[model samples]
Target: MASFAVLLRAVNIGPGLRVSSADLRGAADDAGLADARTLLNSGNLVVTPGSSGAGSAADVARLVEERLAERVGQDVSAVGLSAEQLDAIAAANPFPAAARDDPSHLQVHVPFGDLDEAGIARLDLASPGREMLATAAGVLYVHYVDGIGRSKLTPKVIDRAVGAPTTARNWNTITKLRAACAGLASR
Candidate 1:
């Protein structure tokens, strides 16, 4: 069995993408994922694929999206990370100091694929002061020294610049994900 950290996009924030943890767990069980559990209301799930119909990381992500559509009546999408990948992502934190000292100001922008240097440059220019952007390990760590609210590095800018599906997690969430998926690495 393989463990995966599944991150669903746009969930539980408002009326448009409402979903409960119980509903998510039920749908995951139906999709042949064992030990399915959610981390928070934002749709962070960790599941181990059962001994049947298991496939690659992308395949499981598709399965989750499909099962969510079928059972939850919502076409929820997500990003999947293997245990090892999660390890790399956490280890590659360029702003460890910020993560420790000012966690709320640190944001990790995990893109589906690698982002070019030009995009990173653009993102750097977007912030006028007290902002740092580090592009590493298929992720971008944005350090907003003045807090995210004051920065103009919006998700729209990230998506347009990276030209891919990207979901961001704060330092707190990233650490939580690492802790939540630690069991997979130990196995």
Candidate 2:
């Protein structure tokens, strides 16, 4: 069974749609995913396909989304990446200094669809702070030099600029999730 990281978009950000980590694990279990684990309450899940076995990361994502929708009664979009993909993302980090010195300021945005160059250009033009953007392997790496809270690079702006729905995890969280995926693979 291959390991995968399933990232749910826009969850637990408000009172409207709140999905607990336990509920996420339960959804994965119900979906026949084995060794399901969740990191933080922001919908980061690591799991392996059960005895039935799933096809690609997309297949795993669909199964999890279906089960989670059944449990939560809301459609939560998920982006799944294989263990190797997660490792590649980590390896593709362009702002290593930011990740090491100010990990919280570094964010990795995983897009659900293809990233548009025009949208990326728009994002660069819209940046009013000392934010830096880089793209590698279809993933966007952003370093909020002025910190995220004060920055104008909100989720809406990112989604609109990238022309795709995306979920972002800080550098710290990315490392943790990568470790979780590695652990699942080793077992």
**TM-scores of the models, in the order given:** 0.90, 0.95
Error of 1 at 182 (Å): 1.7
What is each predicted model's overall lDDT from 0 to 1? 0.78, 0.89
After superposing all C-alphas onto the true structure, candidate 2 shows an RMSD in angstroms of 1.2
Instruction: Supply the global lDDT for candidate 2.
Output: 0.89
Among these predicted structures, which one has the highest TM-score?
2
Residues 54-74, candidate 1, lDDT per residue (tens digit)? 566676677788888887786
Best of the candidates, lDDT: 2
C-alpha RMSD (angstroms) for model 1: 1.9
Q: For model 2, name the residue pairs that clash.
A: none
